[model samples]
Target: MTKRSSRLDDAARAGWLYYVAGNTQDQIAVKLGVSRQSAQRLVSLARSEGLVRVQIDHPIANCLELADALRDRFKLKFVDVVPTDPGSESTITGVAESASAEMERWLRREQPVLIAVGTGRTLKAAVELLPRMDCRQHRVVSLTGNIAPDGSAAYYNVVFTMSDSVNVRSFPMPLPVIATTSSEREMLHAQAMIRPTLALADKAEVTFVGIGDFSNDAPLYVDGFITAAELKALQKAGAVGEIVGWSFDSEGKMIRDITNDRVASAPIPPRETSLVIAAAKGPRKLPGIRGAIHGGLINALITDEDTAAKLLG
Candidate 1:
């Protein structure tokens, strides 16, 4: 390497050590076998010469076109595309990777309220990718809840995981999503504990939700929210998939079934930035996903190539 280029490299290295590595000038000097003053000078040189540039590493080219297409088609604020290999583990892994990056961005942004929803494995994977956040001014609230006794309430994990990521306020629903009768639901809604979170959902600035399929193996179904009998009923009713707990058909029209009515009944009035970040793959989700898109429930989406192609198709 040239003499000037070598100096630039040394300066850049020392600058990175001081900033990203959390090293003091003296510490950097010790590590680099230089005096503290020299370390300081190098840092200054790196900055002055523009050798230190902060780059957000994202799969722009591969993901951007698809992202733009979704955004334009669905009026989404943003979309993330994961171009995975055609088969095998590509779908889940790619979606997970993109979600991790997206979650990091969401946590970093200064937002007032984040309303979350429950639906599928892809959402679960995205929730798993969230790191513990430490922001104090933000609030995270669940958009819906589980109803059946066997339902695992995976949305609780979404709340817990997101709360850990940012040291912000968290609101969790402590009731079944649906009651056996309207009277029972009315009583639960009257409870003070549930009312506050319901109020929070009304004021949500952004919402993160996953889409759901009507199949028996759907994540929500497997999580015990939907029983085998219920699956059959939904299938017979021509129910396709769900968005924020609201089930619909192939064209995204609301099914108005009992189970779906439970979710649509949330107290919250949807926010203007009511973003539904749906992440899923496969032909099975096409109807449900397209329905969500057609219904205008999702203002944002993040998914893999296969899923995106299917949706576009």
Candidate 2:
């Protein structure tokens, strides 16, 4: 190698060794007989000249554009995009984990009531990765009714898990999300026992929800909350996706239907709360995800890279 190429190669090797070996600049510099600043500068030069080739195996591409598209379309304050690597569960898990880290940073600000909507496998993944919420005065509310039997072990378990994580109270809605008839819904809402929780939902400061597909395999259907007939009806009615059971069209516009009315009645309006949705998956969720962006229901989003690329494209 020529003199220039030889020095560049040494710098490239040194930089790779430092990065992979988890050594600090100082350590690399001392070991290489150079100043820490010189080591840092050389690493940059190596990278710029393609002397150092770093392979990051990202699952998805255009994550930044996806984040920008989501923010622009939804008018959100922030959007986190994670890469999708179908072959790697660990990569998928890392995306979810990174989203949780970003959420932690956002929550550091003063927000009164943080609402969590229960729907979809992605939401579950995000929640599992969510760091322990440790603000005593702040509260976390359940955005939707539980899918399990009322007061059942599973219901309480989910509620307690969320409550304990934030070290705050859970505004539990102790009622079925969907009722047989409008009259039944009215009666349930009239009851003193369920009124307080519902009221708290109405006053939520921040809401976290998941978007859903109309497929039977969708998270809501698998949760045992909706029947196959309901899913079919939603699809027939041109419903592309749903949030907290409220169906919307491909543009995220609310589809005026009995089911939608029921869903809207069950939860507070997005306009009245700081709405955030944990969005993920690709192609499958695009219609519903796009609907959310159009409907002004979601003001913040946490999503994976593959889904982001689709949205931006």
Candidate 3:
């Protein structure tokens, strides 16, 4: 083999060992008989040269049909449905894999695009699976604050992850997920540090958000952003789902109740101008996903086959 092709082979091997086997750079260097820096460069070369691709390539017929039907029903801009493992009721892995596929498409674009992201467990999973790339042309901004209720940054926030994964410019909202009161929320929103990020989020052409269900294990409540009294109050007002802390009722109407009055999340972009894509699934999020679709909080969806079927049903 030529020297160039031999180098490509080494790079590919390095990538497989690092990404697939979850090996550290030192481990890869030891296995490949190369210096640690060389191993890291080899892995980066593999990804940049297109020798590494991580995706769920299967296009099951039922999933296709469901995706098509969902797109038609909601007038969505895009949709991808993947098969879920029979053993798993929640398809977090499958949804994350599919979301990473779509996110990669945007990250590969040459022209600059403003991409906004919301925080959640599934979104965090998606960012973790993304193959590292150099996409400094695009900008990523967060729709929700990175701060959790307990004063620590929320571990599930995806903006920092996206920045690290793609080497893109990232704007993170350093405020709390939700303020303790409407006046406190206003004060945070007025802060100069976070307003630009929120404004940029409003103009982002592509948005990645997570649909949160108002269930017994609701993310906001579980994360301590909302109290039990707040939860019961919102449910009493017909709230069923939330996107970026903005709660909505089952009929897909944004509720202007207690939690929403104090939410610090950026406003959902206009659906006509932006592609608000979300990755969500499982029985818990079914109501919220459906509500998001109906209310125009999101215009695109990436989910599992079973979830899609139930959404259409």
Candidate 4:
């Protein structure tokens, strides 16, 4: 036999023994009557020569099962469940990483798409984790106001982060999250610059947002976006959660209160967007997440395994 053919046969044998038979290098060396170094070289040759190809089947069976269950139960278009420790902070981090990956995938699509984003901690975290990419073809628009009462950009604003990360043009709603009154909100929405951005949001192919719970410890309240009295009023109005700064009741129906009218962001119906992805995870967020799902506010979700189980329950 030719020398080259003999080497190929030895490589195949070493690869089968090491990979398929699950034998150690030492065992392969002894069984093949070769040194350990030679056995290792043969396996490497097998890989390089395409005699053996390694395929890593990710052991994400549990996560896939949960994701499938969530999709089926909520009739959602997509669902991703990430593993995490037994805590809200860890859960948030896990979900953010997963959501970031999902966003990267969408941004990499060949067809240019508009992405509408909302403000909140979880969404902000996801944007922070997003890898830098030059996706100038895709445009990003804010689904909520960028400014705060103190004349500073809202802490959780996603426009700047997304724009910088993707190096894309962004349309920010240059307004407060909540105007002083419904009339003022109307005036702000009427501005030519603001109107165009809001209009673009309505046409967004995908929307990413963080669901906010109505509890006392809610991020909105803790972040000083809303007063204690305002929070109490929302709770009294049966508010369970919010999406894109629009408060909704336990059934996910928009709560028509002063706050709703004063909200500066244009409200896009959940079903109108091709994809509404929400990044959130925690015990406190359970009710809001559930309400959002039931209300069809979000067709896709990125959350941790613990939250997924609670949601299934």
Candidate 5:
């Protein structure tokens, strides 16, 4: 092997041990079977050679200030604002990963608590980032039905994926999120097969949901779950956002729309002491997030710094 290539490999190993493994110089030296001075030199060399790239996972002072401001403004229970780069819009948008960390924190608790989850791209992305753990002590339930009107499963049903990650017992509502009619939804909700799931969903103290912005790019319309006319009707009814397929207006009140009437998903409004955390970000979601906060639909929030600033603005 070339001497240069060998050195590069050593530097990479040193970087991984010191950064990823959270090892001190003494520990790294012992593990690498080298003197502490040599280990320190290796770590410095790794940084100089660009083998070490440390990314801070904790929120910076600016982000913490933003979080505190949002919480105070809305009288919320918890808030996390992921740091963003002014020049790099893409780099600062890891809200899903940050939310996943919060989810992990709650799941790691020894007490077995009921966790409810909503469906969307945001939630699916967060579930995908979860590290597998033995969390069978807890229970997880879906806040929305798993199917579309066409009988196909919803594209972003997240409880199953979350169950796989944490080894938790999961209950998924097998019906469509929005039935064809109010009567159909009533019939679906009344079914004995779905009763247990709905009942359990009602008891969840910790809930994670995705905020859907009412815009030209609304996920319900884009995913073919709701027709263009239905979307227009929802917008006309003053729906600024949706959670668990229930459309709400700027004041956070459920609008008088057929969409809300036909929704078969478990209707879980903010309960006393319930922790409902919504993960959303970007310019389009500012109004929707504001609406959710105004209505007390979500007591906790996870978002990026850019969106938080826009919401406050």
Candidate 6:
């Protein structure tokens, strides 16, 4: 073999001996006929060259305790509780960063994958934090409409950002957030181009979404996607929060009102999706997050420690 290849082979061996076999540098040196210092350098070289990887499996006590409580309370498949200064903006940032790391790991899977995404500020932040990679084997589909009434894809559009970050194809739902009428929504759903994307969303292995509280400060109203009167009506109808434009009550049952029919994007039934991961944080989001969990809208969650405590309570 060439000198470079031979050196790499030796480094790999040294790394295995020191890390895996629990051998000292001196022992590695004796086995490989190298000096102790040379063995140390070889292990370092192995790590720097990506021939070896180290992982700490030790769990943080507080975080693990909170995670366990949340999982048990909500019957959640997975929960990640990130430490944050309570009530600070870092609450959102911490959750978003953790969710971003999880997304990167999921995208690294060797099998072809489809990731459905929902729109919201937290979800957008997670997408922005995601590491850039060229994952052409994956497809991203939007679980919400791309446009608002004012012809803007401004805040509640994350599919494009995800596609750009990962360099993959994205299928945005080409419809308005709230169609003017039920018939219009039906017509939009019937379109040939829209059908396939919706079908793809139904079969997605994993979906990332955000939970939105149904107060006056609701994103739909604040972003001008819904009128003040509409927000009031939703609240009157016993809505507590929204998931993918569909509002639900505190008990997690869909509030089937006019708004439900007017929503263009069809809600992906939680049972249909293998994994529904919701990333959210903050006191304002706690009610919505709880509603989602109670309703079985999401199986996994990523949120800050404070929010996790609140949810557990």
lDDT of each: 0.67, 0.64, 0.87, 0.83, 0.84, 0.83
Clashing pairs in 1: 76-299, 132-165, 133-164, 133-165, 133-166, 134-166, 134-167, 135-167, 146-177, 252-291
Between prediction 1 and prediction 3, the one with superior TM-score is 3
The digit string of per-residue lDDT tens for model 3 on 136-224 reads 89999998989988899888889887766679988998988888889998999998987888889889999888888888788889988
> Measured by TM-score, how close is model 2 to the native structure?
0.70
> TM-score, each model?
0.73, 0.70, 0.84, 0.79, 0.81, 0.79
Name the runs in model 1 displaced over 4 angstroms: 1-62, 89-91, 115-119, 146-148, 151-156, 263-271
Which residues of candidate 6, in runs, are more than 4 Å off?
1-59
Better of 3 and 4 by lDDT: 3
Residues 1-313, candidate 6, lDDT per residue (tens digit)?
A: 6999999999999999999999999999999999999999999998776566443356678888999999987889889888767546543667776787788888887777888899888788778776668888888889888987888775668988787667877899988888889998989999999999988888888988888888788988898878899899999988888888888888888888648878887576455456999898888778888888888888999987788888877
Please give, for residues 203-243, the per-residue lDDT of candidate 5 as tens digits: 88889999887797798888777899999988988888999
Residue pairs with colliding backbones in model 2 are 82-305, 252-291
Tens digit per residue, CA lDDT, model 1, 1-313: 6998988888989999987888899998998888999999999997776455443565567567777787787777778887756657533666655665666666677755564545345655666666556766666777666444555555534665555445767776776755566677778778888888787777776666666777767655676666778778777787788765567777667776557654423642353646556676666777787877777666677777777866776
Tell me how candidate 4 scores on lDDT.
Answer: 0.83
Maximum-lDDT candidate: 3
Q: In model 4, what is the error at residue 268, expressed in angstroms?
A: 3.1
RMSD of each: 9.9, 11.8, 6.4, 10.8, 7.1, 8.8
lDDT of 4 by residue, 53-88 (tens): 443346477788999999999999889888757534
Mind sharing the TM-score for model 4? 0.79
Candidate 5 lDDT score at position 69? 97
Pairs clashing within candidate 6:
none
